[model samples]
Target: MVDVEIIEMYIPNSPSTLIYIPGITSSLTQPELYSTLHQTFSKFGLLYQVSVKNVDSEYYTYIRYYSARAASRARAAALRGEIAIKDSGPVRVTGLSRSGFPNVPLSRYKCEELANFYLGFSGWRSKVLYHRKEESDPLMVKYVSVVSLEFPRDSVSCEGAGLCEQPLASAEEEGDSYIDIITKTAKRSLGEAFLAAWGKVLLIVVEGSKVQVQINTTKEDQFLYNPVWDEPVVSVSEVEYTQDAENEDEV
Candidate 1:
């Protein structure tokens, strides 16, 4: 019998929120300090809000971005260590597993865009690109598959459960080493289970009712539809339709 390994995953509750712990002692009460932090983080992406909190002389800043991809990029860059701040010591940046603020409604359309961006594509309408690499040796060929996914409108919340590492049959049963089994399983399952097993999933909550879950999968049909922004569209016509109708009646 194969023994499966169940590992607890560390999934981020909010991908768009990041936490920054400054090395130097600074006061959040100061306007200049707030401005400096805001300006510094804004270079990575569009920021929805910036806030600072202090507990026991320890200062922490929560920076929220409009797009999860932007927050992810900022976190990756910050993880390299020692982000410099003007008139202060270098600070360390880390992404928050869960947002400290109350739940803010996120547009379902925007969430889809963010997911596609993380997968290394311009938009959900874009085509999936597959790259094949051939080494000098015939046995070393590699196959890469790229997939895009979008959740249904009913999805209310998303969570990361961590990597699902299942063990294969024992040496006595299959005559394969543990390492070999693990390698084969990871490669085969990683691509198909990447979003559900590793990536963050967003949930959409309906008011006064139960929440619905939307799983991320290949959005082949969604390619025909471009995302529509929430903002109202302005008409280009200088004259009103009512005025045009009145002129036609006069004629």
Candidate 2:
């Protein structure tokens, strides 16, 4: 039997999930600072997003966690002077609450990163199951691709398909551009499909414990369907079994 859980799309826009840290003492322009911040806060829980910005000549950072419990725990730790970055003094953490904040969808790169971070590289795999040219014309070509995502430990697999239309250029010098577009379209389709499937699988970590809650997508995220100017239709859900399962399950 397959353990199927519906990934709910509606994440309550509560302030408890958002954490604000001010006066980091590091230059906000440094790219390494963001990585260090991510590595630090992600330890408390699965982070929704982390960003640092300059405000009034001070470096301020915001850490958003998927789980409010995780946010609370991180705040408690910060209050105790346990959290610091690169010899910076103890950071101050606070919650940012607003009247009606929207739940922005995760990007394809972010989805891949989170999946790898929590599930590990070997925990999940995506394979191209099918591909075909659907239509062609003098100036354009259409192709369709089907991809399968497998999480072996959970005995779960999801299938999704993507459709794309690529424009053809008349100039021979631009042939590489056409091929590159087609290749990118196919990859985007694959990523979009994976986004829809993975979006349903929410990873929530509190303290040291982690949980995966499958939420029913109440509405199709507009972000998942269209990556670029021309939108690709994505279809999902079919299962395949893997023969061998690896034993490196540590989140």
Candidate 3:
């Protein structure tokens, strides 16, 4: 069946709030990938609003936020509000190497929009993060620790290898790359420039030059996101992440 888990879920104030998606490789095989695995769904039923239900066996959709394919599918999910995770979509991966790991220790009681950039990414990243120090719940600290423990640190795959590299594309597309398309949105605020506010939205993969944003629009509303004014790329740099071997026990 489609193994959908909410290991450390804390429904934010709005749909636009950042929701963490850990390793898909693990999400597929791990039962705890869902909220029930974390043992907090029924208790905190007030929080989540069932995004995706019975996903079936092989997972129907699996993709990043920067990919065009991912954007289209995720948008469809937000429409139904009950999408199946892991079929296939655009490739919009946010974090590279170990920085991408859902590396939080405590689930915060309240949803806090944390860090805006991923570690060691360069020139407009394909993703953004809620980088937090604690897990959303205190009681679940142990579970979060388990995740931290299980996160692979020095894998060759993280250093740009394996099935991971197939989804990425050029930075020259539409004057954007998988990285630029995402980092731009995560970092820039359209409202700051007297533009319309972006409501509930989901990001697909960052492929070629275009990164898709699946707006959480209603049936009557259009999924088009047009900015009257877009600020040019001023400075895009890489986020360098170096794992201190001495900090091995830090997680």
In candidate 2 the C-alpha lDDT for residue 3 amounts to: 29
- The C-alpha TM-scores of every prediction are 0.34, 0.65, 0.15
* lDDT, each prediction: 0.45, 0.65, 0.26
Query: What lDDT would candidate 2 get against the real structure?
Result: 0.65
lDDT of 2 by residue, 68-154 (tens): 667788999999989877757678886676826676557756666666766688877877665556557767766766665677766
- Residue 9's lDDT within candidate 3 is 18
- By TM-score, how accurate is candidate 2? 0.65
- The better candidate by TM-score, 1 or 3, is 1
Clashing residue pairs in candidate 1, if any?
Answer: 155-204, 156-203, 156-204, 157-203, 158-201, 158-203
lDDT of 1: 0.45
Of candidates 3 and 1, the better by lDDT: 1
TM-score of 1: 0.34
* Rank list by TM-score: 2, 1, 3
The CA lDDT at 180 in model 2 is: 76
Best by TM-score: 2
- For model 1, the stretches where C-alpha displacement exceeds 4 angstroms are 1-13, 22-24, 27-29, 100-103, 106-251
